[model samples]
Target: MLPLQIGSFTPKAPVVLAPMAGVTNRAFRAMCRSYGDELVYVNEMVMSHAVVYRNDKTLTMMQFGDDESPRSLQIYGSDPDMLGRAVHQVCDEGRVDHVDLNFGCPAAKVTRKGGGAAVPAKPKLLQQIVRRAVQAAEPYGVPVTAKFRMGLWDDLRTDITTGRICADEGIGWIALHARTVEQHYSGEARWEAIGALKEAVTDIPVLGNGDIWEASDAVAMMAQTDCDGVVIGRGCLGRPWLFGDLITVLNGGEAPAPRRLGEVAEAMRRHARLLTDHYAGFGGEEHAMRDFRKHCAWYLSGYPVGPDVRRTLAQVSSLAQLDDVLGAFDPDAEIVEGGERIKRGHTNGPIKVALPEGYLDDPDELAIPDDADVMALSGG
Candidate 1:
C-alpha cells in the first residue's frame, strides 16, 4: 500500500476520517483514534466565518485532545476573502496542522446559496476559494486540502476541472467523494471517477471517498482505483474499530472476527464516556448523554436486540440509564445477517440540486450567490 503524505506529515496509515458535521467531534475522533491513532482524524467541519468571527461554539468545536497529533480541521464557505481570513487565523495561531476546504457538501441548504457542492459548478469561483485558502496557509507551512463531489449532477461534470484547479492552486492533497450533488448519499459511488481523478491530478495525492462500509471495502477501493488513500465516512458511524480493521487489512493481514453484543455494548459505553468528558465544560454529563441519543440507533443498527431495548437506549439521558438498557441484552449474541453492510447516514438522494437562479450561467465568471454567508449553514 502507498503511504499518504500531506505536506511534511506522513500518516502511519493511509486512511482519513471524513469530517461529518455532528458526528466527527472531539469525542468521536478520539473514539476512532483509540482504535488506531496513526491515521488522520479530521475534526468536524466548521464554517469559515465562524472561525473568523470567533464563534464560541465553533471555536470550541475546533478543540483537540492533548494527545491528538497532526491536528486536521475542515472549513467551508463561498467567499475567498472570508475563507482566507479563517485559514489565516487557524494557521497563524497554530491551531491546525492540516486545513481542508469543503466544496462537496450537497445539502439543499448549502447548494441553494451557491456554497458546498454548488461551488464546484463555478470553476472560477472554486479556483478563487481554493487559491485564497492555500495562499493563506502557505506562509504558515500548514497544508491545505479540498474535497468535492463529482459534479452538480450527471449532466454537469466538474471534478476533473476541480482537481486540476486544486492542484494548480497548491493544495497539498484532494479527495473525491465520487457522488454528484444530486445523487446525495443514494446509489453507488462511482469509483471509476476516483481512478480518473487520480490520473488527472498527478502532482498531488488523490484520496477516494464514498461507500467504504467496511475494512475490506477500503482495501478494495485502493486496489481498484490506485488512489493514494481511502477516506472513511458513513462506514465508521457505529464502528470506530473499523479503523483498526483497516490498518490490519491494509498491512497484509486478515480482518478481525465479528464482535459479540457485549463487546458492542462496551464500545458504546466508551463512546458515551468520551462524549461526556468532551462536553464536561459545556453541558456536563447530562447534556453529553442527551447528545449521544442519536448514536444509540447507529450502534444497535444490526444487533438482534429487541425493539423495547432499542427504544429505551435511544432515549437514555444518563450513563446509568445507558448501562441499565444495555445490560438486558445477551452478551453472546452477534450481528444480524448482512448487518455490516447496513448504511447509517444520509442514505436518501437523487433529488434536484437547489442552486441560485442562473448560478450555472457562467462557469468562468467569479461570483457569489445572493444571501449566502458562512453562518447560514454548518458542515458538508
Candidate 2:
C-alpha cells in the first residue's frame, strides 16, 4: 500500500480513527493508538465558537498526550470566519499536526441550524470554509482535511461537487461517509460514492468511511472503491484493538484472533483508569468513573452478563464500585462474536435537515447567517 502524506507528515499506515463526539476523548484515543502505529486519531469534533471563546470543555477535548503522533483535531462550524479563526488558533498554538473539518454530522440540531451536513449543500460556503481553514493553517505547515456525507438529502446529491471543491482548495484529504443527511445512519453507506470520488480528484487522497466493521472490511473497502485509506467509525466502537487488526491485515498478515472476555475486561479497566487520570484535577476518580458509566454497555456489549450485572455496572459511581462490579464478571468467558459491529452511538431516525433560508440558492459563495454562528445542540 502507498503511504499517506498530509503536509510534511507521512503516515506509514492509511488507517484513521474517525472523530466521534463523547467517544473519542483522550483516554479512548490513547487506547486505540496503542494498537496501531502511524494511524492518525482525530479528536472529537469541537465547535468553532467554543474553541474561539475558550469553552473549558472544548479546550480540554483538544488536549493530547505528549507522545501522540500527528496530533489531529476536527472542527465544526457553518461560518467561514469562525472556522478560520479556530484553525488559526490551532496553528498558532503549534500543538496540532492535522485539522479536519466536519460536514458529515447528521444530528437534527446541527442540520436545523445550517451546519454539519447542511453546510455542504451550499457549495460556496463549503469551498470558502475549506479555503479559509487551509489558508489559516498554511503558515504553520499543518495540513487541513474535511469529512462530509454524500449530500444533504437522498434526493439532493452534492458530495461529488463538494469533494472536488475541497480538492481545488488544496485540502490534504477528503473523507466521504457515502450517506446523505436524509439517510442518516439507517441504511448502508454507498461505496460507489467513494469510487466516484477517487475518479473525480487525482491529486489528493480520498479516504472512504462508513460500514467498515472488521479488518477485512477495510481491505474490501479499498478494493471496491480504490480509496487511499479507510476511516473506521462505528466499527471500532467496543473494540479499540480493531486498529491492531487493521494493521495486521494491511500488512498481508491475518487479523489477530478475537479478544477474550478477560482481555476485554482488562482493557475496560484501563480505559476507566485513564479517564480518572484525565479528569482527576476537576472531579477525582469518582466523578471520572461516573462519566465512564456511559461506555459500560459499549465496552461490554456482547458479553454473556445478565441485566442485573449490567445495571450494577452502569450505576457505578466510584472506582471501587466499578472494580467490584467488573470483578463479578467471569473474565474467562469466551468472547462472543458479532458484538463488535453493533452500533454504539447516535442511532437516530432521519428527519428533515435544517439549513439557513435560501442556502441552496447560490451554491458558489459563503452564506452564513448570523444565527448559524452558534453550535447546534445535538450535533456535538
RMSD (Å) of each candidate, 1 decimal: 1.6, 1.9
In model 1, what are the clashing residue pairs, if there are any? none
Model 1 lDDT per residue over 40-139, tens place: 9998889877888888878768888888888999988788888899999999998888998888877777788787888888888888898899889989
lDDT, model 1, position 137 = 91
Stretches of model 1 off by over 4 angstroms after superposition = 370-378
- Clash count in backbone of candidate 1: 0
Candidate of highest lDDT: 1
lDDT of 2 by residue, 180-241 (tens): 88777777889999999889877888999989988999999999999999898877777889
Q: Which 10-residue span in candidate 1 carries the lowest summed lDDT?
A: 369-378
lDDT of 1 at 322: 93
The alpha-carbon lDDT assigned to residue 321 of candidate 2 equals: 77
lDDT of 1: 0.86
Worst 10 residues of 2 by lDDT: 371-380
